[model samples]
Target: MQKDIELSGKLGKKRGNTKSKDCKTKTLILGCVVEKPATVGEIFKRTGFTGTYKSLAGMIRTYHDYGYLYRSGNKPFTYTISELGLEHLENPRLAREALIERRQANAVAVTRRFLLGMDEESRNNFLTEMGIQPVEQHVTIAKNEPAKPDKVTVKVLPEPVEKAKNEIKTNTRTEYVSRPEDLELIRELEEMLASVKEENENMARELAGRTIAKAENSTKKPPKVRNYDELLIRCKDTVVGSSFFNEVPYNLYVVIAELTKASMKELLKEKLDDVLGKKDFKKGRIVLVSDVQASALLRYKFVRKLKEEEYEKIKPKVEFRSDGVYIVVDRLHFADRMCDLPQIQRKSTPIIHHS
Candidate 1:
């Protein structure tokens, strides 16, 4: 008998847990849109929600009817939680209790209707299964109250059945009654759902066309080689000069100086006599004083390993400015190595200023 009691306790606890989860359905739906507006698809993708899309959409529509959610566009309508919805999320006890009460009342109404539609024998069997004594037994027990105790063995209705009866008595509440405005909102929601369906079909066609185009382009073009070391060697060998003076560009030293935390002038201060050495430029510098000065004018980041697609099309190019000469490389390269920079905000400098 103790084992039976334990088993029943476990079953009852499982049922209660399920009931608790069911009561929080509205609260879960409202929580999904508390941070930002989201379509049903986006909410599922972001939250890893496992419910059916149609069921979620229906709940959102109901919340909108209650003014707990705001619906934005018609194309796959996005939902945002309203201020009232936020209030409900923070203190959901009252709302959850009311929902559970309404559900219980609705369940009783449905069961009563089903019993009324059944034959007498079927109705008796249904009530017996639910542990409810038939209506005839109630009459019999009242009549036999003064008789022997053995005759009063007919069981009384269980607690759930008694509760169901009380709920049915108070089931006249009209909280879910549809007003004219609600009907209008329902029509609009239906229209928006239909529009979303049409848009999805169009997007499918567009995606198929793009896939075919991509395949054809892939067949026409051969993939380019992307060797980081080879590119680095070529970039290092890049020389920039006029007929009057030809030499390796000074911009490379500027990049090395920036990496080593030394200024361009400091790096070249010892090497002045090597090429455009200091003797030629008044200072013992190999290049012009103007060129050395130009290198330190503007702050910029150096590009390292390029992404495959960028490597295929982009070649190293030198850009000249009044203040400095710098190399322009693929954006992805700079993005990949940006973390190495001491100040991350200096990742990229905007070349153009718009007023």
Candidate 2:
């Protein structure tokens, strides 16, 4: 049984345990490495690993082989996270969620293997214990075989005999007495049943209360929309003289215009640079005309993938207009604010328009 349990990766062993291969162990190992490079002994102690020293060493070797860890030092080998491992640990929430999913899948697989190893009766009992009903096999009988009696019936007695039997039964019923122990047992059983019923009722009430609370939470109104103008002002102030402003690609403006309902002609006519050059623009004066443009800009400039921290930093600066378009009120203003016009000091040159 111990061997089987160990093979099944369900053993409660202190050393050389199969749990070292589990997602939780892997996560712990990565977390420890992220904190600082450590030797095998340090990692095991920090992570509270129950596996043998030899096993821990082997696991570290495996991690190094998989490009998740890099080994350093000779006498007392130290381990550090590789670039790939750092990427995995970059988002702790995603890593933890993935670990949870892996654990659930492993649990299901283990349960299936355990059930498959059990005998028929034991399997049935296991299913019943888990609140599941086992399927029963239907048996067929041959047409030539004699039918088995499920019940037995006796013929009626003669009238005189029947009358005497009825009189005896009536006398017995009239003189029947209940034993003290039997009565006490009946009372106890009734009390137990009542208690069970009350418990069930309490559980039902609790379940109902939770359901109602969940519904209320689901139906609650969303957070109030933030003022776009204020957000634009903040962005303009923060980014105007920042290094990130200079890094903004010139092609992004063309891309934004191409993605929006407004044409390049309209943008040029408005003197795009001048309109955004003003620092005292009124609140709600500028509206976004294209969601595609905003999304494209965000994807190109900020993050192409979902990361909560980066997303939050850029989210406040953009808004989705009711007209199904996304707009950045400060796009032109911020860009214009970044220009060092006085520093140029050169004669005005003819601007070349590239088609």
Candidate 3:
């Protein structure tokens, strides 16, 4: 019941001349992700309906494009609302109202996918760096809510139960008294919110020059590599500029397999997958050279592939970085034993040994 009320507010906000049945249906979907992000299958079942998965997915896609929602990778349960969406539930801000307006407008706009096509935080921070703060937002649920009325009454005429039942069955309409005073207050509140937006724009408008200067001035710390396990998780099949390459021997595929606990084919595929696009990754089989030899530009190719994939299912990206390189992707790892590469930059770097 409480959820229905919240959904009603979202739906009401989206109602406008361009309203569509699909948009209203989506307003009702906040309950699902608000509780926890759900897969397409779960959302359809949660709604207790069939034949609308595509529509729901499409709406989810649109929201994701706007950053009100997002998608996970290499697994199920892809859709999720951003923290901004949750905040929008509590604060009826301009961004939130704009999403509602856009939903209503159905004017068909294009939304950019996340930066480097990564998770929401990485993507958002990247956007913030670009000086294009994400504007898409949506209301989730507020801690405060209208108290439930103690009672509800239905006025009935002095008619027999049979007659009253028959009359209701036939459906007679009842008109409520018009309250222009209340309506006028709603108008004033709307105008006040708009005025506040105009004032804010005048105060803090950022130009492209400032945006570029800020980016140039910003210090993006070299992403510190965490524990081997964490890095392994993030870069499962993905590559980075700091991986092992040109370190493997042709005859040691078996030994390499044992160290990584993977088959020779799995290891080879991992290397190629790290180096190529979907097309290249799909064609995973490749010849092995005696030593791993891959290039920085190839590593860049792998990074751009992630950008292009954009929320599509991708294996956890994995790279081997030592003092030698900063983002060593498997695509850059030519041989099975590429992980054996010696330190080229710093002498104090530890080997990949876990107790």
Off by over 4 Å in 3: 1-23, 49-51, 75-77, 90-204, 207-355
Residue lDDT tens for model 2, 12-72: 5453634334555566677787645666756765666666656777777887787778664
Q: Candidate 1 residues 192-224, lDDT tens each?
A: 555645655686799999999988897664222
- Expressed as tens digits, the lDDT of each residue in 1-355 for candidate 3 is 1233222222245455434334444555544566555556456556653344566666667666666655642223245556655664344254647777645433212112223358767765665575543322332221233322431223344367666765653443322322445446545644655565554455446556678877897885222221232433444356432132211111111111121324324444434343222222222322222222122223223211123232122212333444221222234353231222221223366689888
Which consecutive 10 residues in model 1 have the weakest lDDT in total? 335-344
Best by TM-score: 3
Alpha carbon lDDT of each predicted model: 0.44, 0.45, 0.39
* Residue-level lDDT for 10 in candidate 2: 32
Worst 10 residues of 3 by lDDT: 248-257
